[model samples]
Target: MADTAFEAQGESVEEVFRGATQALLESMANPVTVSGGWERAIERTDVDPSTLLFDWLSEVVYWKDAAGVVFREAPLTLTREGDVWLLRAGLIGAPVDQQTQELHADVKGVTKHRYELKQTGGSWKVIVVLDV
Candidate 1:
């Protein structure tokens, strides 16, 4: 197996995270085929932006595995409180139906290998490598 990586750039941190999640989700399953029925609320915190993205993505992966569901969208808010990065997300999706939905490569986990999160020129940029 080889490392699979994706990059997302946005004007805001929240947008970048959303884009990153979209990339990850699309790599695992077809978002369009998964009904936006199931829902999960997640809250995570970290001291650093990079770590926050890593942990939050890992948590998303955990939910996907634990619930045996595919997600279509994650409406989230990423904010800072006293130097801590807080991510609160409402993840929406449905149980994967093999007969109706298409599943792609399975994601093993989010890895720190070549993980990056940075802001340059008023835009946020991220590069995440997934263990697939």
Candidate 2:
């Protein structure tokens, strides 16, 4: 599989995170074919946004690697307290089945190289590179 990289931007933090999540799934499979058969809640806390984004994507990759589950939809909420940032995500998708869905690239992990998250002109933008 080839390396897949994409950038996502949104007016709010939640929207950007959601866009990133969708981009990840789309890289692996066609979004139209994947259905929401199961739901998983993921929670992570980090001292900074960059680490939070890395860890969040890493966890999502772990799910695909360990459980054969591919997440298609993510509704996320982010909150900050002091220096710690909390992320709560409700992810919905189904386990991989070759007969049911066509899988594309196998995302090995999320890379920190060139990874960035920032706000520009009142919108949040995130750049992510996935190892496939």
Candidate 3:
């Protein structure tokens, strides 16, 4: 793949995933933590690598909606098993009460618009547009 796909110049998929997780961590108001859910999920099924990005991100939104927790980090793993596309990841963060926080309308999914991880310099950055 072209190096231009990464946000942190010259980064690989692993690096991009790491950077995106870190960026998500920094954007949160509180510290979010991840459990072993990611590993367990990945081990359980088959999935497409191309679809993993959106599924992984969407899962984050699902957690926020279900638990009201904006994760400080999203540790995602994409692997293929058979013909299925599996997305396994864990989220870390504190839960925000529905009454106290001004919650925006929940995001339905991620958009394909500018959805890329690029490498700039010696690091990676992710540019993602959410589709609500």
Q: Per-candidate TM vs. native?
A: 0.93, 0.89, 0.54
Global fold similarity of model 2 (TM-score):
0.89
* Residue range 45-108, candidate 3, lDDT tens digits: 3343434554565566666667656554556665555787455665655566455433343455
**2 or 3, which is superior by lDDT?**
2
Model 2 over residues 40-114: C-alpha lDDT tens digits? 888999887778877888888888878788766777888889999899997788988777777888898899867
Off by over 4 Å in 2: none
Model 1, which residues run further than 4 Å from truth? none
- Which residue pairs collide, candidate 2? none
* Candidates in order: C-alpha RMSD to true structure: 1.3, 1.8, 7.2
How far off is model 3, as Cα RMSD?
7.2
Residue-level lDDT tens digits of model 1 in 1-132: 496889999999889999998998888889888888799888999888888888888888887889888888888899989999899998898887888888887789998787789999999999898988
Model 3 TM-score is 0.54
Please say which candidate is ahead in TM-score: 2 or 3: 2
Most lDDT-accurate candidate:
1
Candidate 1 local Cα displacement, residue 24, angstroms:
1.0
Ranking by lDDT: 1, 2, 3
